[model samples]
Target: MPRHYVMCPPRHFAVDYAINPWMDPTVPVDPERAMRQWTELRDTYRRLGHQVEEVEPQPGLPDMVFAANSGTVVEGRVLGAKFATRERAAEAEHFRRWFLEHGFQDVTMPQETNEAEGDFAWTGRLLLAGTGFRTDPRAHAEAQEILGVPVISLRLVDPRYYHLDTALFVLSEADDEQPAQIAYYPDAFSPGSQRVLRRLFPDAVLADAADAECFGLNAVSDGRHVILPVEATALAEKVAARGYEPVFVDISELRKAGGGPKCCTMEIRK
Candidate 1:
């Protein structure tokens, strides 16, 4: 398993701006509680024997807490995020510099708008890219060329599942004995994309409506172990029965800004 470095923002973490549908400037976020919840998440990763490194957060970048959007890294090389929206454009530079300074090779900035791991994840051999949300389809083409991996584009349909990470869970990237396993919500995807998913992953775990609401697909999996939101009790039980050891982590505060475990943790492939 790859170890990840998560960025813990300073006390400045709050809903200063409404970038995503889940964000509402009127709602108040308790920074202290959010920080505590985030810290505990980091500690949970450490307890699982994964290395956790922190990036010093800037005061104004409240969204920096969702570190996985930083960029997509493959074998130490990176493709810096080019945000589709103006609100997050400033973050592209910050993420690029962090990768360069943290022993990762100088990353290539994509011409098309893409939100790094926020729209891209690995299925071991192929890169499963998401579109019709934060990422553009052109970005998918750019990613395939930049990363030299086959890119499978999945179109998202629902605004509630804004990011692919919110609608699909990559359970097991292809291994020797098994092909890649995924869990996803069909309703969140376009009919064609849902059909594509079924054709590709016949045994995919179809998430229930209740589980999707709790951000069940946004959970993080480290092969045998899965980190699920505390609200996803039913999904947790199902995952356990599937032979994965379910580790529960409460990230209610982070979800207010629209993120879960995978959003905070970006795997560094070495």
Candidate 2:
């Protein structure tokens, strides 16, 4: 069974409501709002037939996002993350307890780079690491060393899109015979990144900015299930048109703090 893992709140990281310069002050940071959105997101996954494992946050690790930054597996492992932000440097320390409590062994940290696992993706074969922002350039080599996976690291050139998952996602076909689809933002892919991807996927689908902002190509999964922001109607339409059911829920509260649905949720077991 597929497992959707999430970290409960109060354990979440939020720039001090007073110091958050990203959003307009007029925008409220009501705890109720965040809870409502997070609850809806959790329920959506549960309703989709996925086993939901809402992990409790560890003490001193105030960031719920720390769960996503670390890599996890349903029956095997739950590796902790090495965060780039000093404020979040202690992010992975709690994993030792969580892993022990959950009975997962092999939960280890990657090499010495200040990088987050959210900065990478496991494509069943190779691991793609995103450079810049939360992950440093040298960290890619470390991922290869620690994860023991063939690693291909690409640099993200835009600040607007902090992670590679923000602009690139993979879609697998329902029919076992159909080839998997890779959707990506052409504008967001720097020349070097583009070259790297081209070498990896010779026929990847290059999506436009409209789709990127719409969240249309930002997420990739089965046609029956897609993960995206509730407000991304254009993206929803495309998914629906492709004969998939889209579960929409408000995560506007998290977006104010620099994350969306994808950033908040990570798949643990497939």
Candidate 3:
């Protein structure tokens, strides 16, 4: 099925500050390489028959390229983001304006601190919300109210997988032809959360530490094609084995700031 996605070019992307475990300011980031990788990802989406929309990248906000944190949109309704850190506080307004200008009438800026899709994964039927890292626990309720979906709270245990998008992703949403599915790293979540996931998605693709560290779970799936990091070879095999085509893209430059394919792409469901 074709999907709509929003992406920001990595024109000014860099790991200037250490916010996540993957970010190392000392490590040099090649802006040109990042742009190449981002463009390839966007082009790949277009090739797959998905609609790709660009958000103008702003200067100084190095992490602005991780557009998935912008907001959560479902059925034409949007729940705007509220970053937990001051470094990314301004990104919320940029994304909010984009939604309004794009003719999204119901855009609500949340009072609670939530990194939007960075910590929220929509499963068609409900929302899987993450906390104990970037997003506040209260934001789960706010998302549930604004998006009008049942929100399941999952607590993150690892700093490396700070955002839910880094640790988990929806593989395919429930439709008349298939059931909702997901892929995730169990160790990234608390024991209870792990149990919840096990019960909810018994057939979910489970990634080992090696694949998770490679940002394997940070993937985007349009029900058929799963776009993921090229470094996650093992996870790609698993994804392919599940009858979904695994498309790889090397976003190593962007990974310097703790983002992968899913982190750079936000699915807009209408």
**130-216, model 1: which lDDT tens digit per residue?**
998789899999998888889999999899888899988888889788899888889999999988899999987788899899888
Write the residue-wise lDDT of candidate 2 on 119-224 in tens digits: 6666666667787667777777766665566778778777666777777776543235654455577677689888888877776656666656544443535446
lDDT (Cα, tens digit) per residue for candidate 3, span 5-72: 99999888888899888999999889999999999999999999999999998998999999999899
**Pairs with steric clashes in candidate 2:** 12-64
TM-score against truth, every candidate: 0.96, 0.81, 0.98
Candidate 3 wrong stretches, greater than 4 Å: none
Candidate number with greatest lDDT = 3
Considering TM-score, which of the candidate structures 1 and 2 is the better prediction for this target? Answer: 1
C-alpha lDDT of residue 180 in model 2: 45
| C-alpha lDDT of candidate 3 relative to the true structure | 0.93
Q: All models: lDDT?
A: 0.83, 0.61, 0.93
Backbone collisions counted per model:
0, 1, 0
Kindly report which residue stretches of model 2 are placed more than 4 angstroms away from their true locations once superposed.
Answer: 10-13, 17-27, 58-62, 72-77, 114-117, 173-178, 202-207, 210-223, 240-243
Among all windows of ten consecutive residues in candidate 2, which has the lowest summed lDDT?
15-24
Q: How many clashes (backbone atoms < 3 Å, residues ≥3 apart in a chain or on different chains) does model 2 have?
A: 1
